[model samples]
Target chain A: MDFFIQLFTDPVAFWNSHTLLIAQIGINSIIASSMFIVLYSGQLSLAAPGFMAIGAYTSVLMDLHWHTPLALNLAAGVVLAGVVGVLVGLPVLRLRGVFLAIATIGFIEALRLGVILNLPITGEGLGLKNPTADPLGGINMVLVSLAVVLFIMWRLTKGRLGAAWAAIRQDELAALSQGIDVARYKMIAFVLSAILAGFAGGLEAHLNFFVDPGDQQYGVTRAVQILTFAVLGGSGHFLGPVVGALVVTTLPWVFQQAHDYINIVTGVFLIAVIVFRPQGIVGRGGLAIVRPAWWPRRARVSAPSPG
Target chain B: MDQQLLNAIFIGSIYALFAVGYTLVFGVLDILNLAHSAVFMFGAAITYSMVVNHGLPFWVACIVGIAACAVMGLVIEHVCLRPLRRRRAPPIAALISTVGLALIIVAAIEQGQTGSLFAWLWVDGPNSVAFPAGTIPNPTWHVGDLTLEASKVAIIPISIALMLVLGYVIRYTQVGRGLRAVAENPRAARLMGLDVDRMISLTLVISSALGGLAGILFGVALSDISPYIGRDNVEVRGLAVIVLGGMGSIPGAVIGGYLLGLIEVLALVVLGSNARGGVAFAALFLMLVLRPQGLFGAQLRERI
Candidate 1:
C-alpha cells in the first residue's frame, strides 16, 4: 500500500528514494524485451543469460584492464555477444520447442559453470569487483536504453521482418511453404535477442559494484526469471514483457506486507494470473477477466412473457 | 576406483528414480513438470519432519511422505495443468504455472519456523538438515577399500526393483495400456473409451510418488534434506538425465541416470570437482546437438 501510495501521491520523492529499484526495473525490462524477441519468433530459446554473461564479462573486463569509456566497453561487449550468438545460434537453431529450451539451458549452465567460473579473468567463484561503478547515476542511462530498445522492438514487430517472424511462429512448415526462410528468421531473432541481452548486461554491470557469477546472476535461474517476465507479461505483444518485467521486479516491494511469505504470495499470484490470463496480462483482448470453466455462471432472470 | 564405482551406482539409483518421474509425465503429456523437483524436496522434508518432529517411525514416515507427494501431484494437475489444458493454452504456459507451484512449495518449506504459518510442514526456516542419528538404522560395511552404509547400499536394490516394477507395469498392465493409449494420442484414446484426463492425473500421481520416494532415499543416503535439495541436487541434472537417455523414454532415463553418475564421477576423477557440473551440461548440450532424439527416443517431434 505504501509502495503504491508513494508512487501515485509523491512521484519525485519516490524516484529519489527508490532509484535503485527503478534502475533494476529498467534492466529487467531490457532483458525481458530480449526474451520477447525469441518468444515472438516462436522460439523458446533461453540463451539470454548466456549472452548477458558474455556481455557483462567482456564489458567489465575491458573497463578493468584498459580503463576504456563505458560506451566503448558496452559496444565491445555487445559485439562480442553478437559474434558468440551467431556461433551458438547456427547449430542450436536447428532444434525446436522444448528441445531448444533445454539445449539453451545447457548452453547457459555450461557458460556459467564451465567457462565463467573457471577463468581466472572472471575472478572464478569470487566474482569481479567494479571499482568505478555508479549505481545511482546509471539509472537515467538504463531508462533511456530501455525506451530505445522498446522503440526498436515496436518498429521491428510492425515491419516485414516481424511478419516473417509471426508467420514462422504460427506454423513453421506453412511459413516455409509461403517462402519465408524459417531458419534465417529464427537466427535473426536469436541474434537480436542476444545483442539486446548483452546490452542489458552491460548496463546492469554498471549499476552494481560487484559482478557476481552466482547461479542467480548468469545461470539457469536468471534465464527462468527472464522467461517469467516475457511469459507473465505476454510474449504476444512488444509491451507485454515490459509490463511483466515491471510487475515482477516490483513484486517484492508491492508485497512487502507478506514479509517472509512473499514467495508464497508470488507463487500464488503467478499461478492465478497464468490460470486466469493464460495469454498474459497484455494480450489481444482488452482488460477482460477470464473465468475458468468450473466457475458457475450467474443465474439469468428470464423476462416475463410479453404474450 | 572400485569405491568410486560403488558410489556412482548408489548415486545413480537416486538419479534414475528422480528422472523416471520426470520422464513419465513428459512421455504421457509432453509437458515438463517443473514442480516435480518441489515434490522431490517435499517428500524428503515431510519424511524428515515426520521422524524427527512428530515421532513417527521411519518406514511409516516414508509411506506418509510418498502419499503426500502423490497428493501434491494431484494438486499440480488440477491447479496448474488442467485449467490450461481446458483453455488449450500453449505448453509454455504450463511451464510458468508449474514454476509458480514450485516456488510456493519451496517457500512453504523454507518459511516453516516454529511459529510460522507453515510450521506444520517444515520448521527449519531455510536451513539444511539431516535425519537425526539413529532415526533410521544405518549400519556400515567395509569390503576391502570400499566402505558402504546400509542406507546407500539399499538405494541400488530399491531403485532398481521399483524401476523394474514401473517398467513392467508400463509395459504389461491394463493401466499401462491406458496410459500408453493416452500418450500415443489423446483424442484417439478418448474415442477408444480411455479417460485421458484420468490417465494424466494418474501419471502425475505415479510420477510424484516415485519422485518423493527418490527424495526420501536421497536424504537418507546422503544425510541431507532441505528446501533446496531438489533444486541444488537434481532439478537441472534431472533434465540432463532425461535428455541423455532420450526425452519421454523410461529405459533411457534409467540408463541416462547411471551414465550421468558415471560421467560426473569420471569428471571428478579427471578434470577435478570444478569441472564436474560443467562436464554434465556439456554432455547434455552435445547430446542435443548431435542427437536430438536421444538413445531411445523415437524421431523428434517438435513441441512447445
Candidate 2:
C-alpha cells in the first residue's frame, strides 16, 4: 500500500528512490518480450537465458579486457548471440513443443555448467566484477531500450511477419498449405527473440557490479521465471508480457506484509490468477472471472409465455 | 573403477524410481507435474519430521511419509491440474500452476523454523540435516577393494523391487488396464465405462507414492535431507532421465536412469567432477536433437 501511495503522492521521489527496481522491471520486460516472440511463433523455445548469458559474457569480457565503450560492447554481444542463435536454432527448430523446451533447457544447463563455469576468462564460479557498473545511472538506457524493443515487437506483430507467426501458431499444417514458409518464419522469430534477450543481458550486466554466473542468474530458474512473465502476462498481446513482468517483479514489494510467508502468498496468487485467467491478464476478454464447471449457479425463474 | 560402477548401480535405482512417477503422469495426463519434485522433497521431509520431531520409529515414519505424499498427490490433482484441465488450458499453463504449487511447498518447509508458523512441520528451517546416525540400522560391508554400507546397499533392492512391482501392477492388473485405457484415450475410456478422472487421480496417487519412497531412500542413502534436495538433486536430472529413456515409456525410464547414472559416473571419472553435471545435459541435448524418440519412445507424435 505504501508503495502505490508513494508512487501516486510523490512521482518524482518515487522515480528517484526506486530507480533500481524500475530498471529491473525494464530488463525483465525486455526478456519477457523475447519470450513473447517465441511463444507467439508457436515455439516453446526456452533458450532465452542461454542467449542472455552469451550476451552478458561477451559484452562484460570486452569491457574488462578491451575497455571498449558500452555501445560497442553491447553490439558485439548482440551479434555473437545472433550468430549462435542461428546455429542453435537450425537443429533445435525441428523439434516442437515440450521437446523444444527440454532441449533448450539442456542447452542452457550445458552452457552455464559446461562452458561458463569452466572458462577462466568468464571468472568461472566466482563470476567477473564489472567495475564500470552504474547501477543508478543506467536507468535511462534500460527504459529506452525497453521502449524500443516493445515498439519493434509491436510493429513486427502488426506486419506480415506477425501474420505468418500467428498462422504458424494456429495450425502449422494449415499455414504450410497456405504457402507460408513455416520454417523460415519460426527461425526468424527465434533469432529475433535471441537477439533481444542478448541485448537485455548486455543492459542488465551494466546495472550490476558483478557478472555472477549463478543458477538463478543464467540457469533454468531464470528461464522459468521469464517464461512465467510471458505466460502470466498473457501471450496474446505485446503489452501482456510487460504487464506480467511488472506485476511479478513487484509482487515481493506488494506482499511485503507477508514477510516470511510471502512465497506462500505468491504461490496462491499465481494459482488463483492462472486458474481464473488462463488466457492471461491481457487476453481478449474483458475482466471476468472464469467459474469452474462445478461451481454453484443461480437458478433461473420461469417466465410466463405471451399469448 | 569397480567402486564407481557399484555406485552407479546404486544411484541408478533411485533415478529409475523417481522417473517412473514422472513418466507415469506425463504418459497418462500429458502434463509435466513440476510439483512432483516438491512431493519428492516433501515425502522425505515428512518422514524426517515424523522420526525426529514426533519420535516415531524409522519404519513407521517412512510409511507415514509415503502416505502423506500420496495425499499431496491428491492435492495436486484437485488443486492445480484439475481446474486447468477443466478450463482446457494449454500445457504451459499447467506448468505455471504446478510451479506455483512447488513454490508454496518449498516455502512452507523452508519457513519451518522453531516458533514459526510451520514449526510443527519442520523445525530446521532451510538448513540441511540428516537422519540421526542410529535412526536406522546401517551395517558396513567390505569387499576386495570396495566398501559398502547397508543403508546405501538397501536402496538398490528396495528401488528395484518397488519398480518391478509397479511394472507388474501397470502391466497386469485391472487398475493398470484402466490406467492404460485412459492413457491411450481418455474419452474412449470414459465412453467404455471407465472413470477417467478417477484413473487420473489414481495415477497421481501411485506416481506420488513412488516419488515419495524414492525421496526417503535418497535422504537415507545420501545422508542429506533438506527442503531443496528435490529441486537441486533430481528435478532437472529427472527430466534428462525420462527424455533419455523416452518420454512416457516405463521400461525406457528405468534403462534411462541407469544409463544416466553410468554416464555421470563415467564423466566424473574421466573429465573430473566439474564436467559431471555438464556432460549429462550435453547428452540430453544430443539425445533430443539426434533421436527425439529416445531409446524406447515410439515415432514422434505432436502431443505437446
Candidate 3:
C-alpha cells in the first residue's frame, strides 16, 4: 500500500505528517501500561476508563475554576484518581474474575450515566471546552511522560513488590499462605494503575482541547480497548502492552482501505490471537507451546522435562 | 399501582427470557457468553425477516427464529469455546473471543442489511426494523379501577411457563440430569458416564432458544427493533437479572427479573427516566458490594 511505501521511503515526512498519530500512540501506550499493572496483579479490573475520566475532569475543572498551574492541576488529578481508586478498590477487590469485571463495568456506566452525564459542570454530556488546551504542543510532554512511566514500570517489576505481584497472579491462595498480603498488593497495583490512567487522561484531554464525556470516551468500549492492549500484546511482560498499543493504534492507518471491514478484521484477529497465542504477542519464548503443561506432567514422557 | 405492576411484569418477563439463557450458559460453563446479546438481536431480526419479508406465518417465524438461534449457539460453542476449552485457557480468553465474535456478527448483520461491500452475504441489518404485523395485538382489559394490556397477561404467563418448563426439565429429564451433573462437576460427570460435551451443547441450544423468544417478544412489546439494541436493552438488563436472581439459580432469575423490572419502573416514577438507568446499575454495584451472593444464591466460597 502507498501508506507503507510512504512510511518507509520518507521516514521524516511520515513522522512529521503523523505527529498526531505518534502522540496518540504515546497516550495509548501509557493507558496500556495502566492496564498491565492490574492484570499483572491477577485482578481483572476494568476500571481504567473510570479513573481516566476522573483525572480528565478533575484537572480541567481545576483549570476552569481556580486557574491552577498545569503541574498542580495534573498532580491533583493523578492523586485524586488514586484516592478514588483506593476507595473503589476496597469494596470491589473482594470479588475476583468475572464478578469483578462486571462490577467494574457497573462502576463505569454508573459514573458516566449518573454523575458525569447529570452534572452541569461536565456540560451534561455536551462536553467541555478547554480554552488553554495545547493540542499540538503536548506531544513532547506525552512522549516524555510515556518514557518516564515505562522506565518506572520496568524498574518496579524488577523489585520485591513485583515478585509479590507475580506470586499473587500465579495463585492467590498460595500468595496468602506465603504471607504476601494478597489484598494490599492488589490494592497497590490497582491504585498505581489508576494513577497511570489518570495521568494519561489528563495529557489526552490537553491534546484534544476538549473534555467530552461521550460513551466511547469513558465507557465500556474504552475499557475493552485497554483490555485488548494487554491481551494481544501478552500481559506477561511490561513491553507486551506497549507494543500492543502501538500496533492496535497504527492498524487503522495501515488498513485505511478496509475501513468499513476493519472491525471485522480486528474481531477476527482478536479471536485468532486469543486462540493461538493465549500468552500474547510479546510473551516469553517462541510460538512452540509444546510444554509439559500441555500434556500431563510426568505422563510417561520418555524424554527429559521440556522446560 | 396495579397498572404499573402490570407494566413491570411485562418488561421484566421479556428481560427474564434473555437473562435465564445467559445464566444457563454461565451455570454450566462458568464463562460469560458475550455473544448471547448478539444472538438475542439476531433472533429479533430473523423473526422480522421471516414474517415480513418471507411472508411466513407468525408461529412459523417463531419456530424458524428459535431454530436459527440454536444453530448460532452451537457454532459459537464450537468455534469460540471448544478450542479454548481443550487448551484449558482462562475464563477471560473465552470472554474476549466472544466479544470479538459479537463484533463480527453484529458487523456482518450491519453489512448484510445495508448491502455494503458484500451484497451476497446480506441479511437484515443496521437500522431499526418494524415488527411484522398480525403477530400479536395490544388490547386493554378493564375491571373497575384496574386496567391492563391483555398482551401483558399473556407475556408474563409465557415467561412463567418457560421458567417452569426449564425447572422441570432440569429436575426430571434424563438430559437435565446430565446437565446438572456437568454443571456440578464436569470431571465427575464424565467419570460417571454422562456425556459432558453433549450436555453443554444442549445447554447452548436451549439457552439460545430462550434468547430468541425474548427477542421476538421484546420486539412485539416495543413494536420495533434495532441492531444496537442488544447492549443497552437486553445484555445489561439480562446481566442485572441473573446477578439479582443469584447467578445460576433458575427461580432466582425469575424473581430477580421481575424485581429489577419493578425497581426500574418505580425508580423512573421517583427519579425520572433520565436517572433511572444509572439507578439500576448503581443498585447492582451496591448489591454486589453488600451481598455478592445476590439475593437468593448461596454464600460464595473462594475456590483455590
Off by more than 4 A, model 3: A289-307, B117-125, B132-135, B140-147, B150-152, B299-304
- Looking at model 1 chain A, report the run of 10 residues with the lowest lDDT sum: A286-295
Per-model chain B TM-scores are: 0.97, 0.97, 0.92
Superior by TM-score: candidate 1 or candidate 3: 1
TM-score comparison, 2 vs 3, better candidate = 2
Worst 10 residues of 2 chain A by lDDT: A289-298
Q: Which lDDT values do the candidates have, in the order given?
A: 0.93, 0.92, 0.83
TM-score of each: 0.98, 0.98, 0.92
Model 1 per-residue lDDT tens digits across residues B105-186 = 9999999999989888889988989998998888998888889899999999999999999989988899998898888889
lDDT of each residue in B267-291, candidate 2, tens digit only = 9999999889899999999999998
Once superposed on the true structure, which residue ranges of model 2 sit more than 4 Å away at CA? A304-307, B299-304
Q: Is candidate 1 or candidate 3 better by DockQ?
A: 1
Give per-residue CA lDDT, model 1, range A148-183, as digits (tens): 998999999999999999999999999999999899
Top DockQ: which candidate number? 1
Q: TM-score of predicted model 2?
A: 0.98
lDDT of 3 by residue, A161-260 (tens): 8899999999999999999999899999999999999999888888887888876788877898889888788888998899889988887787788777
The alpha-carbon interface RMSD of model 3 comes to: 2.9
The order by descending lDDT is 1, 2, 3
List iRMS for all predictions: 0.6, 0.8, 2.9
